[model samples]
Target chain A: MDHFILMDAGLGNFVVFVVGPIFVGFVIGALYLIIKSIVVIRRELKNEKASDNENNEQIK
Target chain B: MEILIYLIEGCIGAGMLFIAVKFTILIESPIIISGGVTENKKYIASINSITNVIFNVVLVFISFYKWPVSSILWYIIAEFLLIPFSEILAYRAISKASVKQIIKITYCANLLSFVAGSLFVFILIALLGLF
Candidate 1:
């Protein structure tokens, strides 16, 4: 059998390949989520400020 | 020696979980706040974010325990399942669902994924102990 398959056959190789990548992917995915959220939050805050300014101008 | 490995594993596991939860919250926050959804939906999203953080912490704890290869396979499976599951839950919660429905679905999905991930880690450790 190939090395990868052999590794899969045993638990140790499985941990290094399968578990390791999954954890790494999870971390990356999480980081992506955080960055995306921050951008969205900033946009929303800007919109809120603009709307507030519009209302004030209308009153004046 | 094992202790050192366990410690390192614990740190990495916890760090990953923290990052994941933080990212999820950041991704969903704007959607919940600006979607003009009901207050209930907003509240549910907030609760889901908090729960996700807590769940990741628990996963970190489990990962720290150390496990054999057979069990590690299960952990890998659990981790894979959580990725899409969490995304769907967040999407649904922040979207058009009624507050009640959002709460039920988010909670169920998050809890299920968390438990599965934790169990997989736990089982890996247990199986390793057998050898």
Candidate 2:
């Protein structure tokens, strides 16, 4: 029983040490791209609206 | 020693935050400037290019920070996974497809990114048993 517990603990430690960072990096990098894209899209929308308004004013 | 580690981590955290913000600005600026003139596809492509460059820089920074053959290898692999994951999430959230879609996809994307970033640090600590 004691040996089994020790083996489990060691495995857990390895996962934490080796796999955790890679997972965290993957998630964070995903989030960064998502946020950056959103910002760009919003800016684009605002520009589109502004241009539409300018075009309307010219017509009037 | 703890203080030293924290300080170094803090600096790295700050640097990462700054780079993220810089990329956001770079992606946004062009759309704002050429709003009406440029097609949506073109604008998005430009933003994608800028984001890619920023991502590359970030990967390079992470590599240097972890320098010393043994430790750095895992970190670089982690970075590789991160770059694409973030990009796909952001792109999906941004490109709302139809013109009439009323949902604030951009805002959603940003919020998701912020949460993910914070959670990532915690996950890293847990994984590395650094804390």
Candidate 3:
């Protein structure tokens, strides 16, 4: 199976396309995760500030 | 033979795309975006690589569908034509650069890479034929 696929240029390219980009896609995916986490953290902080403001208002 | 040639061209084309994008980012940084991709270059490069891979795969499927043997040259005309637009859109999504800036950078980059890659392939083919 490996012999047949490895010997052919066409099959070999598919391997390059797939295997080569795994690292690239993985890195990009990690960047996306970091961006997402930052956005989520910002939203959470904003919501906490909003809740804290409401509590202060209630106490006043 | 045709399929083999096509596959070889595809591999070379993809490699050229990366080199072109990287170089274009450096060259255009001063004139276009003024360090737009500087800090996020790693991210952007990875994204561009992924986008390029997706397009190449699509081209392969399209080219291989109708025939058992195919030429990458004719299909490449269509591929290069579409690549810049997709690349522009991809770059625009990740950066704060203006549309005009993105378009110019992507266009120059794709053109440079396509010309270089195709020339290399043709030369290689010619060299092979000589022996």
Candidate 4:
């Protein structure tokens, strides 16, 4: 268990009550960015594969 | 009226869980376990939200009727001990992250939620004061 009492109560409270939520929001935003990147990468792979098939058919 | 209040609190609890978990997973390795990370997050968050709401209500009732503990002691137990412990276990069961990673995520995420919840209640109290 965390001994929050022995620590600096004022500073801990300030961090948790003031800065904490903002940090959480930033992390959540980064998670969304990860999702966006994944979607983009998948789309790029699909497009590349489609183009590859087109070239192969044309060559035949 | 109490039912409406419970419904509102339940929504708030679920929303808080969703927001907290959405972020906490990024605190460590952004593990993409062959897709469906989002699905897992939703599943875990739903379980957590329900548990949290019920636990809080029980805590409140316990502090009043059953146990009758002091405010400070109750706060310490609920915030420092029980809630975080439960969250850690919940994350561990559902999350594929390492033990260290899950611990960090749960603690930090709970801190974030504590801050937000305090502000939320403060706002609600303030709004009530106006009326």
Which candidate number would show the highest lDDT if scored against the true structure?
3
For model 4, what is the alpha-carbon lDDT of residue A46?
64
lDDT of model 4, residue A44? 49
Give the candidates in order of DockQ, highest first. Answer: 2, 1, 3, 4
List the global CA lDDT of all models.
0.53, 0.52, 0.55, 0.53
Off by over 4 Å in 3: A1-60, B1-39, B65-81
Most accurate candidate by DockQ: 2
Residues B13-112 of candidate 1 have per-residue lDDT tens digits of 5566665555555554454445433334334344444446434544544656664454465445544455435545545533555655545544454445
Write the number of the candidate with greater TM-score, choosing between 2 and 3. 3
Candidate 2 residue spans exceeding 4 A from truth: B1-38, B42-131
Q: Give the better candidate number (1 or 3) by DockQ.
A: 1
Which of the two candidates, 3 or 4, achieves a greater DockQ against the reference? 3
Error of 3 at A21 (Å): 18
- Which lDDT tens digits does candidate 3 get at residues A1-60? 977766797777776765445444434444454455446545644655687689899999
For all candidates, state DockQ relative to the true structure.
Answer: 0.07, 0.08, 0.06, 0.02
My TM-score estimates for the predictions, one after another, are 0.37, 0.35, 0.45, 0.44
What lDDT score goes with residue B6 in model 2?
45
lDDT of 4 by residue, A1-60 (tens): 266664778788767654455445443444444455446545644655687689899999
List iRMS (one decimal) for every candidate: 8.6, 6.9, 10.1, 13.3
Superposed model 4: Cα runs more than 4 Å off: A1-60, B1-39, B63-72
Q: Model 2 misses residue A23 by how many Å?
A: 1.9
